[model samples]
Target: MPLALDVLAQVPTRREAVREEYLRRVIPQFTGHSIGEVQWSTAHGDFHWANLAGPDLLVLDWEDWGTAPVGFDAATLYIYALQAPKTAARVRRSLAHILDDPAARVAELLVCAQVLQAADRTSFYATLAEPVRCHLQTLASRSA
Candidate 1:
C-alpha cells in the first residue's frame, strides 16, 4: 500500500496539516478492508496508455506493482476511462458490480487522490492548471 502521506510527500504544494486531517478521516474507514496481496505476473506500476500495447490489452510497465490492492489497477483504469463518456459509463457499471459501496468510497477517495496528485509539483497543475491548485488552497484554508 502506498502510504498516502509518502505519495503526498512528492508533491510540492501540499499542506501537511490538511493532508493529515484528510488521511485521519479516511484511512480508518479502510481499517479492516485489506485488499490482500497481489502476486503479479509482470505487474505494471504505471500501467497507463502510454506504456501499453495497441493490439492486445497486455498491461506494460511492471515497475510499480508488488503487493498492491486488488482493485487498485481497476481504479486506474476507471480514472483513464473518465476521459471518454461512454467508457466512463461502462467503468462505472463495472465498478458498481465489483465494489460494495462504490459511491461513498469513491467520493472520499477522490478528495484524497486529488490531494495526493496535487502534491506532485511537476504534474499538469504545475504548468497548465490552476483550478486544482486553487481548490487545494481552498481546502487548506477551510481546514485552517
Candidate 2:
C-alpha cells in the first residue's frame, strides 16, 4: 500500500478529492479548529479494502485519484480498518509518519465527517458511525 501511495504521489492531476472548502466547513464543525490551510497531495481518494487487491498490491478505482489532504489515503484506510482492531493498529503503525502528524488531522476529520454523513442516509456505514464519532471526539478534544 505504501508503494502504491508512493507511486500515486508522482502522478500529476489538478483534481481535489477533498476540497479546501469542504474542509473549511466540516473541520471546524467537528474539530473546532478553523482550518488555516491543508497540505495537499496526489492520493487514492478512495483507499479502502474494496479498492485494494492482494498478492501484489493493486490499487483500483482510479476515478478518484487526485489531490487531497496530505495523509488522506492513510487516514481513510485507517478509518475503514477500525472494524478490525489488529488491522487498524497495523495501519496506524505503518502509516504513523502520516497519521501522527497534526497535518493529517484534517484528513482524519474529513473522512470521519464523510462516514457520519453517509450514515445519516444509509446503513452501509452505520456500523462505523460510533467508532468514527468517538475518534472525532478524541480529535475535537485535542484541539480544545
Candidate 3:
C-alpha cells in the first residue's frame, strides 16, 4: 500500500469502484461524505502482507489497481491488520499523515463496510467486526 502522500503522485488511479460506486451503492453514509464526494487518487486495489516482499521492498497483487480515495491503501492495510492490534498500530503510526486526513476517515469506513460485507461470504474477517463498529461509532461521534 502507498503510505506516503508522495506515492499518490507517482501512480495514476485506474478506473474502479474504489472511487466510483461501492460506497454510494453499498454504503450510503461514510464518515461525513458520500462516496462520490470523497477525494480520489491512484491506489493498489488490493494491499496486504502477502503481496509485500521485504528487504527488496517489492509489492505484488496489482490485479485491482484503480483510483481510490486518498490514503485508502493505508486504510486497507490497517483494516487487514485489525486481528493483530500491534501491526495495526504500526500501520497507523507509519501512515499517520494519510490516516489522519479527513478523506482517509471515509476511506477507512468504506474498508470497514467491505470487511463487514465479506463476513457474510466467510468468517475470515469476523475478528474485525467489533473494531469496525467501534470505529464507526467514533467517526459518527466526531461528525455529531
Query: lDDT per model, in order?
Result: 0.39, 0.82, 0.72
> What TM-score should be assigned to candidate 1?
0.43
Q: Model 2 reaches what TM-score against the true structure?
A: 0.88
Whose lDDT is greatest here? 2
The local lDDT score (0 to 100) that residue 97 gets in candidate 2 is 78
Alpha carbon lDDT at 141, candidate 1: 56
Q: Candidate 2: list runs displaced more than 4 Å.
A: 30-33
Model 3, TM vs. native: 0.83
Q: What ordering of candidates by lDDT runs from best to worst?
A: 2, 3, 1
Using Cα atoms with residue i matched to residue i, what is each candidate's TM-score against the true structure?
0.43, 0.88, 0.83
Q: Write the per-residue lDDT of candidate 2 for residues 1-144, one digit (tens) a residue.
A: 456666776778888787788878876675455666788889989999899898887878878778998889999999998878899899999888788888888789888878876886788689988888778777778878
The lDDT, on a scale of 0 to 1, for candidate 1 is 0.39
lDDT of 1 by residue, 21-66 (tens): 4434443342212222222121233434466675755556655543
Runs with alpha carbons beyond 4 Å of true place in candidate 1: 1-43, 94-116, 119-144
